[model samples]
Target: MNENQSSRRRFVVSVGTAALVGLAGCGAQQGESAQTSTQQTTTQTETTTPTEAADTPTTTQKSSKSDADGPVVEMKTDNEGSYFDPKGLVVEPGTTVRFVNISGTHSTAAYHPDNDDGPLRIPDGADPWKSKLFTDTDAVFEHTFETEGVYDFYCAPHEMLGMVGRIVVGEPQGGPATESPTDIPPAAQESLPAVETIVSEQRVSGP
Candidate 1:
């Protein structure tokens, strides 16, 4: 073959080889980009699934006491009488009773059958169990009934005029309204101070 023709053929072959190499490099780059995009999409999906599941609303359990089971009573002190509005309250063993004192100088005192006989007055280590005398303004108290029994309490200064209240804590086997009698301490029953029931109006605010 002639020298110039051989040189031209060699140049053409070199150009073709260079073009093939460039195309292979472009294919490899595209494959790597596709892999990276797929991985990012998978990661985002995994992160969002758990967050959406956590945001789902959960159901709350209801209390055992039905609306018809017991009456929602109030303890109020008014001009006519300074005493517990309902005079009595009934609750189940696991029920929680809230005492909102709206008026008068009063306290929910629950001493043992013999407060003077020893230090076994009221339950041991009860948290805010005893409500202090309401001399200044209105206050609120709450207690949970865990044991199945009756709890008798009297006002510190108004027990003489029969300012007493009872908490029947537990389910009655026979039927509703059945309660066991609570024993009041002798010292508490002896002489309760006589104080005028201070009547005051309380403003309760809520939505």
Candidate 2:
């Protein structure tokens, strides 16, 4: 072979060997790091993130305020939406829930049989008491809940307009009194929001 042919052949062999060495180096690098990268990815996926706005149960009991100074559910007029303002509350047992007439006549009566309108409902062994026509403003009627249960009440006149409210008295000694709202009167049942809404969202203090 001539000198040029020999030089060209040597250059070609050198290039092929360098390429083989480069491919081997790349394989070794991938083999070393592939497992580590996979481990890192799995760790990132397994980490748990915190939630937003965790729901907390809160209960507001009746302070030392007298019947006149207590929380007043407004007796709304035709112009105003005829629903109980605040809709529900959590009060201590023996705390008297006072219903004050604001405009229209309203009644805060329980879903109990003593009212001649129930079949052992709302609360057990609890006398259902409703006020006479509360036509004047600040005209009040009150009931002290000694039992630990959910009490749903409604206005006799405007119950169809969804004029209703709920009260959770002390820490309930019982689980959900009723499985569902099937037994409750359809007008009264549909009037108020579910009592679960009050029980789950609120807790009674001092007990």
Candidate 3:
């Protein structure tokens, strides 16, 4: 072969090899870019899904203050007469009775065994029981009964005028109501002079 012909064939072969190498490089770059784009899309999807779930609301529950499995009783106060509206009350042991004083200048005082004034006597070894005195500025008294027996009480100032009450603490026998007689122990019962009931209005502040 001639020298110029050999040189032209060599140049053509080199140009063809160069074109194949450029094509392979471009194909590798395209495959790498496509893989990176797919990974970025997967990461974005994983991040956004949890954020959307966190924004949704979740359910919650609440509780009540009173138990539905216990017994309920109501007692009222009266001022038109010098006696408790329901002069007699019955409750089970460990029951709480709320005494709402309707008028002022009244108190529920237990009859001391010695029949004295200040403090009164409760049943032997029973939980200490005392109701706050509802005076001209105080109006409510609450007491919890924790023993089984009968309790007789009278007002400190009006015991002479027949202002008295009784509380029978225990489970009722035979589901019947027991009447409280005017004659209770520790205090003699006698019908006295009736006095007109006085209605007094007063505001009480809380501690």
Give the per-residue lDDT digits (tens) of candidate 2, residues 13-34. 1222222222344353544322
User: How would you encode candidate 1's per-residue C-alpha lDDT over 1-207 as one tens digit per residue?
Assistant: 112211011111122222222234435354432222222111000000111232221221223223353333244466655565444444555555555556666665454323222222222222113454554343434445455444455666765555655455442232111222223434433322211111111111110
As a whole number from 0 to 100, the lDDT of residue 150 in candidate 3 is: 52
What C-alpha lDDT values do all the predictions have? 0.37, 0.51, 0.37
Q: So what's the TM-score on candidate 2?
A: 0.57
Off by over 4 Å in 1: 1-75, 113-128, 172-207
Assess every candidate by TM-score. 0.42, 0.57, 0.41
lDDT (tens digit, per residue) of candidate 3 on 33-129: 2222222111000000111232221211112113252322222234444555445555566555544455545666555433343233334433332
By lDDT, who's the top model here?
A: 2
Q: Could you list the CA RMSD of all candidates, in the order they appear?
A: 31.4, 31.2, 37.0
Is 1 or 2 the stronger prediction by lDDT? 2
- Residue 138, model 2: lDDT of 63
Q: Which candidate would rank higher by TM-score, 2 or 3?
A: 2
For candidate 2, which ten residues in a row score worst on lDDT? 41-50
Better of 1 and 2 by TM-score: 2
Off by over 4 Å in 3: 1-80, 113-122, 127-132, 136-138, 171-207
- Find the number of clashing residue pairs for candidate 2: 0
